[model samples]
Target: MTTLYLLGSAAPPVLDIASVIERAQARGYDVCLGLTPSAARWLEPGAAGLERLTGHPVRSGYKAPGARDVWPPADVVLFAPATFNSVNSWALGLTSSFVVGFAAEAIGKGIPLVAMPCVNSAYARHRAFGRSVAELREMGVTVLYGPGGFEPNLPGERRPGGFPWELALDAVDALAP
Candidate 1:
């Protein structure tokens, strides 16, 4: 089975990651979850559940410098609900968090990466956000945004009914070489 690293930031839908894993499995991918530090804190109570669901530990921090990587090599990556801070940090090579480090390395490794940001329009206006998105796209990461992809919600507006995980998955398939 193909291995997909589903890296999530602390966006709203990180709480529903179980569904994302189920969706990935249904599509025949072996799922592994990697969460940013804040995201891990938000999911602390459910760590065991996540481990059971993926049959692999949810990586939130780097292991000891020489520790073995337990998860399978990633065939592709899905960065769903990628957040403003994480995207910017990732573009800047700030890998203090596991998810950012994984994303940065994956890009360099030529692993197909697909991201869906859950930013409101107000935050999307930040200059750094645009630069980061452009940088990620330039690096060959398939960012599902703009026309025909994920749209930013307006500030104070409830998020759309469903986050677009399918788009991320399809982008991964399309980008796989």
Candidate 2:
């Protein structure tokens, strides 16, 4: 079974995550989730439900005692709806939380890492953000920009920008020898 780690940002649009996971599973991959603190607020339909759907535990935070051990090295790591904050943090090599920790460890092991950046135009256009993304790319991380033409809402209705599911799955497929 191919192990896939799904990393999500805080308050990601519901449609974005649901569609990404559904598409990945459809391609016959085992999926696990690591959510940011803010992401947990939007996942209240129940993390257990997500786990049931993927048949693996959905985890968040590092200091959750037993939860820290749930993270396993994965074949592929994908961050769907990646926030500007998390992107910067990851770029700076910060592993303050379980999500970040797992990402850092995965990258260290040369695991394939992909991210679907979901941010407004201002954040996406920031010089620092661009530099950080470039740095991650230099480290072999694949960062997919959101598809153009659709404006995302600020307060709510965070539109699912690009359909990054295909790109994510392709990364996994490359690992299958």
Candidate 3:
């Protein structure tokens, strides 16, 4: 089975990540879960359950230097509900967080990558957001954004449509060699 690193940032969608993991598994992926620090904290209480669900420990911070990697090498990475901060940090090559760091390095390692942002419109309007999206696309990451992908909602308003995990998974499946 293909090993998929399903990474998440701090977003409302992260709350439903268990379902996403199940969906990915249903699609025949060996799912490994990674989360940004804040997201990890938010989901701390359920961490063990999530680990059980994925059959891998949930990783938020980097492992000790020179230590073996706990998870298998990712055949592909699906970073969903990437926040504005995560997107910008990743584009700029900031590896302060494990999830973003893995994604940034995945580009040069030639791993297939897919990303879908879950920003509010107000945040998306920032100049950096567009640049970050373009940068990731330029690096050959399949970014699901705009009409056919995720459309940002207005600030403080709930998006009636939930995060588009299916669309992201489709993009991941379609990733080119």
Local distance difference test scores for all models? 0.88, 0.71, 0.93
Residue-by-residue lDDT tens digits, candidate 1, 63-132 = 8988899998999999987999998998899998888999999988988899888788999999999999
Which stretch of 10 consecutive residues in model 3 shows the poorest summed lDDT?
A: 168-177
Ordered from best to worst lDDT, the candidate numbers read 3, 1, 2
After superposition, which runs of candidate 2 have C-alpha atoms over 4 Å from their true positions? 63-68, 146-163, 175-177
Q: What is the lDDT of residue 137 in candidate 3?
A: 94
Error of 1 at 46 (Å): 1.5
lDDT of 2 by residue, 1-177 (tens): 677888887744434566667888887767788888778768867777787777767777664565445545587888766778888888888877667777777778898888766677777677888887788878887777644312334543444544445665676666532
How far out, in Å, is residue 100 in model 1? 0.4
Model 2 residue 147 lDDT score:
44
Per-residue lDDT over 122-151 for candidate 3, one digit per residue giving the tens place of the 0 to 100 score:
999999999999999999888898999999
**Most accurate candidate by lDDT:** 3
- After TM-score superposition, the amount by which residue 78's alpha carbon in candidate 1 deviates from its true location, in angstroms, is 0.7
